[model samples]
Every structure is written in C-alpha cells, then in structure tokens.
Target chain A: MIFIKILSILVMLFYALGSAGVFWGIPAERYKILVLGKFFTWTGFALHTLLIISIILLNGADDLSRGYFMQLLAWCILLAYFIGWRLLKSGFLSLTASPLALLLFILALKVDKVQIEMPGTLKELFIALHIGPMYTSLGLLTLAFGAALLFLHMDRKIKSKTRLTEFDRGLPALGTYDRINHLAVVFGFPLYTLGIAAGFIWAPLTWGREGGILGSWDPKEIFSVFVWFLYASTFYLRILRGWRGRKAALLILFIFGISAFSLLGVNLFMPTHHSFGSLATFTA
Target chain B: MNKHICLVGLNHRTAGVEIREAFALADAGLLENGLLPVGAHLKKDLPIKEALVLSTCNRVEILLAGREEKLEELAIRSWAAARNRQPEELAPFVYVHNDAEAVKHLFAVASSLDSMVLGEPQILGQIKDAYKDALRAGSTRFILNALLHRAFFVAKRVRSETGVASSAVSVSYAAVELAKRIFGDMPSCKAMLIGAGEMAELAATHLMNAGIKSILVANRTHERALELASRYHGLAVPFADLFAQLPEVDIVISSTGAPEAVIRAKDMAGVMRRRRNRPMFFIDIAVPRDVDPDVNTLDNIYLYDIDDLKEVVEENLTQRREEAVKALAIVEEETLNFCKWLESTELQPTIVDLIRRSEAIVREEWTRTSKRLRLSEKDTRALELMLGAIVKKINHDPINFLKNRFEEEKDGQYAGLLRLVFNLDKKELCPRRTREHGSEEAPPPLGPPDGGMIPPRRTPEPAAAFFNRIKEGSK
Candidate 1:
C-alpha cells in the first residue's frame, strides 16, 4: 500500500511536468517539447495503472469505493482525452486536456482514503451501475471543456484580426471544436441520465421504502441536477435555437466548471448521504 | 581537399528586380543554356568541378564546387556574355560566399529564412527545381548530391519545427483566412468581386484556389467584368445588380481604384436585411476604400481594410522572424552534418587505395606461386576466389571503423595516420598537396583528372571545428 501510494505521487508529479511541457510546447511549436510531454504523460499513465491494479488486487472490490473513485475518474478523463486526440488529431486540445487531467490527479491525491460503507440492502450490481456511467459522464464533460477552450482561443484570434499564433494554427477549425463539444454533451448526457436514474432506483431499497427521488438535498445531488440542466440547455440552444461557435463553446465551458466543482468541491466540504466515516479523516 | 561550396548571386537584398530578372533562368532549357558557357569554362580554363544554377524571380544564385576562389569572376563573365552584357554591369549588384558561408547561404535560401518575404514557401520548391535542372545538365555529382539532399531535409525540418510558414502574409491570403473564419471553410461559401483591379483579381484567384462555391464579378464596365469573370470561369453580374445580389454572396473583395467610397453603410443595410443577417466578410483593399468603414458596426458584418491586412502581414512577418532564429539553428546543425559527411569523403581515396594495393600484392604473389607449383586451371581459379573473399573480409571492419571514426573526429588526422602506416602513395589518393605547393598556374582542365577521388582544394581542414566554436560563443 505504501509503495502504491508512492507510485501514485510519482504519477502525479509526472503528469504535472507533462502538462507543463504540453502547455508550453504548442505556443512555441517545438516538437521536442511535445514529444517530451507525450513521454511523461505515457509514463505517468502506466504508473497510474499499476497503482490502480495494485489497490484492486490488495483490496478486492475497493476499486469502486469512494476512496479510489476520484483516481478512477482521473483515469477515465485521460482515456477520453486519448480517444479524442487520436480521433480528432487536434494537438491544441492536448495542451488543455493534459493539464485538466493533471489537475484531476492532484485533486484525487488529496482526496482522503475514506471507505464509505455500502448500504446493507444495496446490491453489488447497483454499485457497478452507479460508478461506471458516472465516471464516463465526468470524463466526457472534461473533454468538452478542453474543446471549448480551444474554440474560444481560435475565435478570439480570428475576431481580433490578429495573426494566428503557432498554437492557433495547429488548432482544429472552429467547426471541429464545436462538433466535439456538442457530441460529448449528446453522448455524456444520456449516460449521466441513466446513472442518476439508477441512483434514484437504488435509493429506496437502501435508505428505506420512503427514500424517493427527493430523499436528500445534498450539495452533490443538487449540483448534479444543475450540471445536467446546463448540459441539456446547451443541446437545446444548439439544436433548436441554432447557437454555435462562441456561444456554444461558452455554455459548455460553464457546464464543465460546475461539473468539476461538483465532482471535487462537494465531495470534500459538503455533508451528504455519501459518507466515508470508515476511512481516513480530514486533515485541515 | 574537397571543392569548396560557393554561392555567387544577387537577390532582392543586393540588387534591383531587373538585375535578378536578367540573370533568372525560366526553365530547364534556359538553365542548360545558361550553364553551357559556364560548364565549358570549367572544362577549359576554370578550376570549377561541379555547378548548379538557382534562378527564381527574387534571386539568381550560381552555386559552384571548385578549387579556385576566382571562379566567381569567370562565372559572372560567362553569365554576362550569355546575356550580351559586360562583367562590370553585374559586379556591383552581386555578392559572393565561399566554403561554410556558402553552405549556410544555400541552407538559408532553401529554407526561405533569407527570403524577401520571410518564411515564404515557394523558395523551397524553387530550390528543388534548380536541383532538378542541375541533374538534367549532368553537372551535379557526389558533393552537390549530398549538399542538396541535406538542404531539402533541413528545409523540411525548419517548416515542421517552427511556425514560420503558418500565417497569411498577403492581403489575398488574409481575405481567404477571414472567409474561412466566418464560414468554416471557404469552399462552401460564395464570393463576389466588386472591381476588376489587380488586387481584387488576385483575391478572386486566391478564393478560387480555396474552392469557393462560385465567384461573381461586378464592375462598372460590363465587358471588363465579363472578361475578368471569364478568366476565372465565374459568373459576371451587372454593376447595377451588385446590391441586389449581395444576399447570395458571403464574401465581398473590393478594390475599385475609385476616388471615393463606392459602397456605403446605407447600401449594406438593405443587403443585410435581404440576407437575414448571415455573416458577410468584406475586404476593402482599395486605397480610398471602396466599402464604407461604418458597415463593420452592423451585426454579422466583418470589414477589414487594406491597412488591417497590412498590419496582419506585418505581425506575421515579425512572428516569422522570431521563428527564423530556431530555423537558423536547424540549418547550422544540418550544415555541420553535411560538413562531416564531406570530411569523411576525404578518407574515401585512402580507403580505396589500401584495398587496391592489398589486392595487387595478392594477385602478383599468386601468379608467381601458381606457376612454380604448376597448379591445375580449376584449382588456380578456386584458390584465387578464396583468397579474394578472405581479403574482403579482412579489410571490411578496418574500413568501416575508419569511416565511422572520421565522422566523429571531423578532421582527417586519424585517416592521415592510417595512410602513413599503410604506406599508400598520397599523390595517388588525393592531389591536395599539389594545390598547397602554390605552383601559381591553373591545372590542365580536360576530360577528367587522373585521380578521380581528389576534390578541389579550397579548405585544407574541415570547417566543422570553426562553426562549432562559433555556435558555442553564441550560446
């Protein structure tokens, strides 16, 4: 466990350096820096996988526990970034997406190893249903944020009549970024809806027959619904109202910010039904 | 000693366009004819070994591989005589580069770092074209072959590793980029040319190349508009209908050379209403500004004047200059790599001689021994074949080691030591000592020299040390 913990920290440090390299590489248009960033990113990812596997083998089924859930979410975000990067071939998005993953890793590292006791009546299948799509939605939303950032950057350059920077030239056309944002929301929204629905269905059995849709008014539940609404509105404005480019990008950015806050902040500070009294305690 | 790489030429920097134009070779035929006199001079009296002529509109550079420093004057005289001019006419406008500076110049030229419009991409293609011409003239050999191929690689590295060629530096290109920003890609959008002026025509051509849906040309003179439209295979609309058709066009490039603004804000109001506020990109490249500047204030209307585009170009140029610093580093690195390969070639003759001498001794001993033993014909043939393979195997590693070590050492000092140990005749391998003796007369320029591997003596030592020292100082 100590070795795993040390490896996790090493992975985080590698990700930080990699994120910095990619951030500076795009603007400078240096292949060496970009390659270095990729090297560190891959090494970090491999080390992170080793940590996750070790934790899973040592503490069986604890992979789905709240203690390791943030780490899983960070891994999912990196997976999503890799898929998008390969499919879209947008080098500029990597500059943003890599840093976002690093930030997630840093947040995950700080997350106290709190083991939340599973409800007695809750089935193992119900936990799987809740954790899988939940992380997928978070990962997809993270990618949307990266695409939105690049779209805004390119929009700023074009609107200002400024010369395109080395980074800007490497960016996908505004159309591609807009499409990525829209598609991520379209795909992630359904998965999120299913996850929330499963959580609602599973609540009655665990918390009692009276535990329903409005059972708890926790910050996590409220903000989850709030993020869903924002994402739904983005689709509504884009498909029906014909909002695109800057407006669409800005809305997706808002959705990502709130979702990120809900994922990290609400879990840390706010009280909720999702308790972790069995694990490590908070420091400060 | 290898022939020094030399570049003697005039560019937009050193000469007027007319002088460059006069010296520019338009095609392979012109290059061949241009090199005919220079090639003959090399064969007759000049000490030049290999030659390549790179002649573009912006520059006409004569790159020569030769022994004498005085080949520039001989080349210039031949070039002048070909064009029915005098040597003095071009002397003031021309500049000369020799040895490492010449190599650097070639690299810079091929990479477009030294171009009038910094980072312009056409220069690389132009350089490749010159290389092809040299191939056709049979004037390019190993030295030029190595230098030019390395030049292409360096150019490619510079382009990929820097942002030198990324931005639009012309008004026409800016217009295309503006259209792309407004309408995703220009090919899906329709464009209108409001005037037949050169700038407007240039923009139309650029838009056509970008694959615009359709181009509509509208001018005050109907026939002129028709003629200009026909050239691009576009539709020619009447000048009166320019306002009525504005709803269909996504981009408007206007440069009428009119004294006053032709299209005002009031005219655009009706056009915008008809178009349902779809974005309209206006590029006013005229001096007096054909389109009203006030129109830019309207919704979905983006207007850029000639001044705005010039500002963009200037900014792009500045960015290219910054990128050029990195590009120069790549060029210098590649130049050093080439110099090393060239220095390694100095050991080629010595290596060849070592093999030849060993084979001769074996052959002579075998002939004397075989006669005394009265060996059968089949046995003698087999013995000779076995001995030949053994000789090749024995010599392979030493030759490979010498080649690899010389690349790292960069000077032929080690190879020279090997030559002395092998007792190889230095004169037979390289005639560098002859040029060092300073006989003060030109060597006979005929069919070919007796020693094929000996190159012209320009630099006695590899320039890799000098250049590496300079790089360290800069750092």
Candidate 2:
C-alpha cells in the first residue's frame, strides 16, 4: 500500500515535468507529446479521487469534511482545468494547472487535519451537504480569481502606452482577457450558491434542527450571500450597459478575494460552527 | 564566347547612397537601355541569350547569360548610358568577371554578399523581382532557373549559419526602439526630421518604416533638405521654422553639424504653449548638440542626444550579425556541394550517348544475321529478345554505377571510364553513336597516379571495386 502511494506520487511528478518541458522548453509543436502529458496528469487525478472515495467508504463520511474538502477540491480544479483548456483553446492551461495541482497533491498527502463523526442513518446525506458543494465552489473561485489577475495586469500595461515587446504583442488582447474574467465570474456564481445552500441544509441536521446554528450572522453564511449578490449584480450590469472595463474588472477582483476568504480563510484562525470537530486526518 | 554571365555591379559597401542613386536604374524600363546593346552585340558575335537588371538603393547589378567575348563591354555601355556617362568613365569603377566567377558573383549578389549593408535580406527580395522581369522577357531558362533557386537557398543558409548580418547598431534602430518605449508605436504620431545630415536621413528612414506619418525635415540648407525629404516623399522647411514646426510634429530629430544649441528653451516656450498636452520625442544627434538641455524642463518632452542614443544602441539585447556566422558556414558547405554536382552533370549526356549508340549496332547486326540465315519466326524473335536482354544487362550496371558516383565526385573523366570499359567507341565496328577509342583499356581513377597507394582495386574488373565499398561500410 505504501509502495503504491509512492508510485502514484512519482507518476504525478513526471506529468508535471513533462508539462513544464512542453510549456517552457524547446517549444516545438509536439502533438503526440502534448496528448501523452495530459493523459498522465488526468490519470493521476483519477487515481487520487479513487483513493479518497475508497477511504471514505471504508471509514465512513460522518465528520470527514476537511479530509474530503481538500481531496474533492483538488479533483474539481483538475476537472475544470481539463474542460477549460479544451473549450477555450488556451495553450498555457496545463502549465498553470500543473503547479497548482502539484501543491494540492502534496498538501493532501501530508496534511492530517480532518475527522468526521456522523449518525448511520444521515451519513450519506451529511457527506453530500458538507463535503461536495464546498469543494466545487472553491474550485470555481480559484479559476475566476486567476483569470481576474491576468485581466488586471494586461489592462494596466495596455493603458500605460508602453512599448510592446516582441513577446508582448503575441499575447491575447486586453478585451479578450477582460471578457474571459467576466465569463469565469458568471460560471462561478452558481457553484457559490450551491455551496451556501448545502452549508445551511447540513447545519440543522448536524448541530440542531433550529436554523439558528447557521444564521445570517455567521461570518461564513453572511460572506457567502454577499459574494453571490456581488457577482450576480456585476453580471447583470455588464449586459445592461455593456459595463465591462477596468472599473467593472476591479469590482470582480474584490469579489474573488471575498470568495477565497469565505471558502478557506474564514475556517482558519476563527471560532465558528463551520469549524466542526474533524481536524486530524489519516496517517501515511 | 557563349551566354554564361556578365556582372557590372555597384553596391552600398562600394559606393555612397548618392553614387548608388546616380547610377541607379530609376526609370522602370532602364533594363532595356542597359541590356539592348548586349543583345545587339550577341547578334553579331557569341550572342546574348537573356538579360536581367536589378537596381535598388543598396545595389545595381546586370545579369547577362550570353555567348559573347565583347558582351561584358556591351553591358558596361548599358550601365554608362543609364548613369549618363561614357563606357570609359564607368569602366574603372566596375568589375567584369565571366564564367564561374560571373556565376559566383550573381549567386553572391542574390545572396546579399554584394549588399551595401552586408547580408541585408532586401537584396534577395530585389533579386526575385529582377527574375520576374526576366521571365516577362522570356530569357529565364534551365541554367538561370537552377542558379536563382540555389542562390535563394544559399542566402537562407548564410543567414542561419553566420553572424555577418548580426551587429547592425544603426542610429535609426535606436530611435525606433526609444520612440516605441515612449509612445508604444509611432503610427499615430507626427514625425519631424530636422537637418539634412546623414543621421537625419537614417532617422527619417526608420520613422517611415515604423509607419510614422506627417513627416517634415527642417534644415538651414534648403535644397539639401528638400533633396533628402524628396527620397521618402516628406515635406521640407527652412531652419528658422524649426520652432514653428516643432508644435505640429510630435517627434523631433536634429542632426545638423551645428557648433552650438539651435533650439533653445525660450524659443520652444511659445511653441509648447500652443501644443497643449501632447507628448514630444526629441532625438538630438548633432555633434555639438541642437536642442538646449533646459527644454527638457518642460512637461511631456523627452530629449536624447547622440550620446544618449549611443547608450540605447549599446544596450540593444539583439546582435545584428548574430545569424551571419552560422548562415555563412551553411552557405559555404552548400556551395561546395552544389558546384561539385554541377560539374558531374556536364559528363552525363556524353556517357549516355555512347551506350545508346552501342545498343543500336547490336540490334542492327542481329536483324541482318537473322535475315541472311533464313531463321524461323520463333527462333528470330527469341534470338532478338535474348540478345537485347544481354546488351541491356551489360550496360545497366555501369550506367547506375556512374550516376551514383556523380554526387560524390565532380570530375567526369573519373566516371567516364565506363565508355572505355564497354568498348562502345568505334563507329563502323560498333555501328552506332560511337567513340574512336573502342579498343583502349578502361581509364584509371586518378589520372594514372604517380605510383601512389594504388586504388584498392588495382584489380581486373569493376565487380571487385563494388565489393570494396560493401566491405568498407561493414567495417
């Protein structure tokens, strides 16, 4: 079992190395090499998800929110990465995703901060409400936030009227970057809504049937709704007045920051019902 | 005296831009003015088969492929007439090389070795345009076509394999880059070329290429200013109008040989007031300087003198002749290989004619023998077929052998030994296109070597020679 884990880790590392070579090395248009590298990365992701599913099934998914959170979130990001790369025709997708995935994979292997305790009858329901949507929301926010940063940098450079380097002229136009950021926010909004709804649904069943456990005052609940509203309004205003520029973009940038804190930042260094008891995770 | 090649060339490295333009084939049809005399002379003596003239700012060259001794003189007159001078006047300044030297000259010109700016790619493009004109005149053929294709490839190789074109730290390049950093691109801005010096001419050249519009050149010498402005089709103004025009032109480049500052802060104060909030690029390349240092005190005016421009030129990350070394190495390697192949091709037709003639005599003898003996139809057909197969089989080996060796060896006499070995030489004896020396033994590889290490196969037959190569590859 230990040996299998080591082999899997090595395969993931090879995928990252190959991805770096194609992205930043000799830069040949290697069709076969590209397909093969993507295959290894996806296969590693699949194995990682499978191992988490098996562990949850054996040990039970009662209070396993953090354990499942990191595992499922890494899986979701990889999922979105593959889909976005295919649909968007973006070349650097693998290059960016490789570093992010490698970090998450290392974190999953070593971080032992998750424990799940649940009643037998509500175990299946609890897992869905607690673990699934939160990870999905975090994945969506990660992509949206990355796109926003790229948009801001490109906008600043273009407006300054600086000389375009040989390579700078080759990048996609500022408007294209801005549009992609808007699209990422539009895509992420529903995932955030689903995560907030799941949190509310699981709160009553786990802590108490009183809706008092997950109230509007809870920082997680309040921030989640605020984020949903911010993105939703931005989406409508963009279509109504064609308001998509630096002003609208800066607003989107703030929303992403809020979304990140609500997902993982709030859980850390804070006392809240969101921080249920399962912290210590599996041993190697 | 046949149509080989006649080169009368002048380029940037050989003459100044003024001299180049003086002799430049400016009129569209000056080629006829140049090549017609060569053509008329070709009619009298070894004739000019075809002619083409390529004239650009960097080089003016006439490529004549004809069969004539006096054709070079005729080409010289053609150039003189274009320059409005006598042949005697133009003769001293020109180089007239023929045959392989002329062939090599045209190749080098097309490859841009003859360019004013060594290894400039514009000459290669100009050469292609020259070839296009030659096509319309119906003078382009196998020899010229092969030469041009090989020349273009050689240019590509020279660029890739050498650094001869790498270190072009020109003033215009520096100006373009600095302007870009300030304004991103100059397409929107108005460009001003102040003074008619060489630096001004170069800066204007760069600006025009960079797509800067509304150009105006101000100089104390109005005619010199006008002459420089006319080249790029720009406007000219008197030196007194420098301040008045500075407000209209966004970019100002001053390159006069002035001893002191020409445009002072007090002078630009009135012009800057009317300009409102526009950005100005001041490139001062004058030796003693042109724009006053105090002018930079005003907002939105970027100033750079010759020293500053030189600093920028020094800092260019790209080396101009970086590719030239690698490109020239490739050019030399490829040229050697190509010339070798060309020499081998000259021997092929003569060898083929010898064999075909041999085969004909055999056929004629077989028919005559069959007719005299009154042989049966079946016997006659079988005999004819059998004899034909023997002849073909005998000739096939040497033909394939000689053709393969052609690529490796340039000299034909080495490979033409097949003609002697086959004994297809006597006319009456062979009864076909035959050589006189049918009975002589096959020729040696190195012209009867001075008793050097004898050919490994100082043996009986070529089959032994075939085994030697197979054994060598195995080893």
Candidate 3:
C-alpha cells in the first residue's frame, strides 16, 4: 500500500514536470526542453503502468476501487494521446494531453479508495468490457475537446488577421486540429455505443429483472443513454452530413462535457446503481 | 611556412549593385566550369594553397589560404585582374578579414546573420554550392576543407539553436505562411491567381514552391492569362469564370487594377456554401483592394490585404532581428572553437619534435652502454624496454607544459621556446629529416584538427569590437 502511494506520487511529480516542460518549451521555442518533457512523460507512463499492474495484483480484479478506475481512465487518456501523436505527428496534442492527464491523476489520488465487489468471473469480464471501452472513448473525446478548442482559437486568429503569439506559432495548422476532431469523433462514438450496450446487457444479468436495462431509472444510466444519443448524432452529422470546422468542433466539446459529467459526477454525487460503494452494498 | 586564412569580399553594405554585378564570379562561368578564374593565378603567382569563390546577388567573397606575407594585396590584385579591373578600383569597395576574423565572417555568412534580408535561408545553399564548385576544381585542399566543413556545422548549430529563419520576411512569403497556418498540407491545396499582376505572380510562385497542387490564372486579357498560366503550367480561365473558379481553390491572390472590390462578402458566402464551408485564403495586393474588407466577416474566409501582409512582414523582420543576436553569439562561440583548432595545428610540429628527440637520445645512450657490458639477449631486451619507459617518462612533463602554454600563448611563443630549450629544431636532430632519410619531406599534412581541441585562448572582446567597427565603417 505504501509502495503504491509512493509510486502514485512519483507519477504525479513526473507528470507535473513533464507538463511544465511542455508549456515552457512551446512559448520559449526550446527543442531540448520539449525533449526533456517527452522523456519525463514516458518515464511517468512507465511507472504508471507498473502501478496499475501492482494494484490489480494486490486487490485482484473482483475488489477494484473507484480510485483505481479513475487512474485507469487517466492512463487511457494518455494512451489515446500517444496514439494520436504518432498518427498525426503533432506535438501540439501534448499541450492539452499533458495537463489534462496530470489533472485527472491528481483527482484520482483524492478519490476515496472503497473497493467494490463482483460476484463471478463472467460478471467481472462484463464489467471490464463496459468500463474499459467507456473510459477509452471518453479519453479520445477529451482529446477531441482539446483539438476543438485549438481549432476555434486558430480559426479566430486567422479570421481576425491578428499577429500570432509565440505560443500560437507552435500550434499545428487549423486543418490538423479539424482532422483530429474528425478522427476522434468517428472512432469515439462507436466505442461509446459499445460500452453503453455492454452496460445494458450486464445490468439485467447482475441486478435481475427489478434492475432493468435502465437500472431502475438510475441517473448514471439515464445520463449514459443521453450522452450516447448526443455522441451518435455528432458521429452521424460528421460522417454523413459532412459537418466540419467550428460547428462540428463546438458540438464535440459539448458532447465531451456531458459525457465527463455522466461518467464521474453522476457516479460520485448522485444515488445510482453505478456508484461503486452503493452497488457493492446492494449486492451484499 | 605558416598558411594564413583570408577573406576578400564586397557586400551590399560596402558596394553598390553595379560594382557587385561587375565582380560577380558566378557570371564568369565559375559555377558551371567549377573553376575559379583567379585560382591558378593565386596559386602560381602567389603562395595560395586553397581558394573558394562564393558569388551571390548581394555579395561576392573569395576565401583563400596561403602565405601570410602580401596575402591581402596579391589576392585583391588577382581577383581584380580576373574581372578586368584595376586593384585600385576594387580596393575601395573590398574589405579583408584574415585568420580568426575570416572564420567568423564565413560562419556569419553561412548562418545568414550577415544577409541583406537578415536570416534569409538562400545564402547557406549558395555557400554549399560554392564549396562544391571549389572541390570539383581541386582548389579546396586541407585547410579550406576543414574550415568549410566547420562553417557548415556552425550554420546548422545556429539554425537549430536559434529562432532565426523561422518567420517570413517578405509579403509573398508571409502570405504563404498564413496559408500554411490555415491548411496544414500545402501539396493538397490549390491556388488561384486572380490577375496577371507582379505581386500576384510572385505570390503564385511562392505557393508553387510551397508545393501547392495546381494554379489557376484569370486575367482581363486572355493572352496575358495564357502567358502566366503557361509559365506555371497552370490552366488559364476567362475573367467571367473568376467566380466559378473561386469555389475550387483554397488560396486566392488578387492584384487586378479594378476600381472596386472584385470579391464581395455576399459572393464569398455563396462560394463558401458551394465549397462546404472549407477554409479560403484571399490575399489582396491591389490599391483599390480586390477583396471586400467585409468578405472577412464570412465564416471560414481569411482575407489579408497589402497592409496586413506588410504588417506581418514587419513583425517577422523584427522577430528575425532579435533571433540574429542569438545566432551571432553562436557564431562567435564556434569561431573561437575553430581558431583554437587552427592554433593547435601550429603547435603540432613542435610536439612531434620533442617526443622524437627524446626517443633518439635514449636509444643512442642504451646502445653505447650495453656494448661495453655485453649483456645477454634477454637482458638487452629488458634494458631497452626500461629505457623506452624512461624516455616516455621524460617527455611527459614537457608535452603537458607545452600543451598548457599552447592554451595561453596564441602566437606560438611557448612552442618556439620549447624548440629552443630542447634544441629540437637543429637540422640533423629534426625528426622529419631522420624519418624520411633522403626524400624531401612535404609540408605537414593539414588533416582533421581533432588533436589538442582546447577552449579558445582569450575572450572575444577584441573580435566583438572589431566586428562592431566593421559594422559602423560599412554604414
């Protein structure tokens, strides 16, 4: 436990340092600092991976906590960023990914470590499928949100014909941001739908007929359905309707906000079957 | 004999364009033939060992490594004679930098810090081409080869470590930069030239060089449009088809002599709808403004008139000037490093002589003493080994002391003193003579100067002051 605590702190420190390096490097136009930032990020990621493996080994899959899931989500976000970075060849994504990951990791540390129980092996697999795909989709959406923000900023700058700041100069082209947004939405929406469908299937089997697909009208379930609809519409508009640029970017940002609230806020604050402690007690 | 590195040249600051044009070596078929017209003259008439002639529109510099005596006067006279001019006429316009100053000048030139448009990138490529020409002509040997390679390294260092050359300094380049900001991949983007104007043509050329897929030309005169279109291998469309072509291209450059705006906001709105709101860049270089200022109000439309591009150019030029200061510092640091290497080359003969003389004395003493004792073969071998170790031990301190002195003494005073103290320079005791026996030994081969690669002997105060004096005098 103490080792886990120390490892988490180290992960946070490296992430904080990496984000600081990236932020400082962009405006200062220093390549060495950017390289140092990348080194720190990779080191932190390696340590974070070790921490995740250790947590699963110690607690076992059946007794995982909400805090552990939060850490997993942060890891997934960083994973998404690395994949995007490789495909797009844009360092600008780190400008958003680094800070967002650091923030999420810190938030994960603050969350209470109350382990939830799962009854059987098949149910545990179902839960993993439900949560894993959902978290990964959210992670990609978070990046899409970041790309949208940059797109709007660059769009306004070009439209206004304003002199670009040093930070602005380091940003990728507006088209690059648009492409990232398009790719994120196209991939994210399908995984999100898969996650929701998996939850619908798992809830009936675990809670019986009393907890239907809607999970007895739980706020988490209602919000998940709402976010899925929003995501699907965005996906449809982007692919079939050829929606692009500012309007599409704005819609992606809106969907990401609601999805984040549904995933985290409803589970922690609202009374729902998806709340880890409540679900564990109800099962007992 | 010591070889002096010298640079004789005239730039925009020192001479008018007419004088620069007259002295341009590139025009005399130097680059094509890969021969310097003055190379043979300098090598035969003077003691020049290596020569490289760099001629660009803004400057022409002749870099030479040769005998220090009369180097400046003879190099200038030969360069003038090659151009069919008198030495007196060229002397007033030309400035000379020797030794360390020459290294600094070459580095500054390669880094584009000395360019007329500060931080322009063309100068480095021009230098590389000039070096290649000199190599093909067999004029650049040892000293010039090392120096040119060092200059290239310094240029690369400056470019990567500083923000110099990161921004556009001209109107057309600024337009292209803005287009790049809007559209990430230039090769996929198409451009349209709305009129056959000079500024529009320049912008089209810049876009083409940036790898835009294709260009469309529209002009009031169909022949003029065809002429411009054929030059770029683009299709020429009629003036009436301008609105039709607007929806096709991502970039539009307009400099037509129309009395009113050629592209209006409402028209752009329809075009944007047809283009599915894809981004469009309009560069208006016309006096009356070919693009409506209100066109900027439309979604996904970026419009920049002549004044806005001028502002961007002005801002970038200021940014480049600031970056040039950092670049100059890098050049100064690298220049000092190269000079240290040059000074070590001067210390090479003395260091070699010291080791060789010590070994000779040790061997002679061992041979004479062992003959009287009549030692066995094994004992003789052991004793010779001990004597060899003693010779190494004896030469250690002198070598270290000379190296230490070399770092402090820039004029080779300690090397000369070491020679005198050890009597290492006597004709009979000289290692070069004994090793070669009968054949005439060539001058020391100026190989790579990796040996004795120490920090510079003194601070850059004198070099900086000299640079400032040149800058002031040129003005």
Best-fitting candidate, measured by TM-score?
3
Residue B260 in candidate 3, Cα distance off native in Å: 2.0
Docking tier of model 1: it is incorrect
The complex in candidate 1 yields a DockQ of 0.20
Off by over 4 Å in 2: A1-13, A19-95, A105-169, A202-284, B1-8, B26-51, B64-78, B81-84, B91-125, B150-409, B419-475
User: Candidate 3 at residue B192, lDDT?
Assistant: 91
Chain A only TM-scores, each candidate in turn: 0.87, 0.69, 0.86
Q: Predict model 2's lDDT versus the native.
A: 0.60
Top-lDDT structure, candidate number: 3
State the local distance difference test value for candidate 3. 0.79
Worst 10 residues of 1 chain B by lDDT: B456-465
TM-score of chain B of each: 0.72, 0.52, 0.76
lDDT of 3 by residue, B335-428 (tens): 8998877777776677777888998888788778887997899998898898889888988898888788767756555665566567664534
User: What TM-score, computed on C-alpha atoms, does each candidate reach?
Assistant: 0.78, 0.53, 0.84
Clashing pairs in 3: none
Candidate with best DockQ: 3
Candidate 1 residue-wise lDDT, B176-222, digit = tens = 87677666766778888988787788888898988989889998899
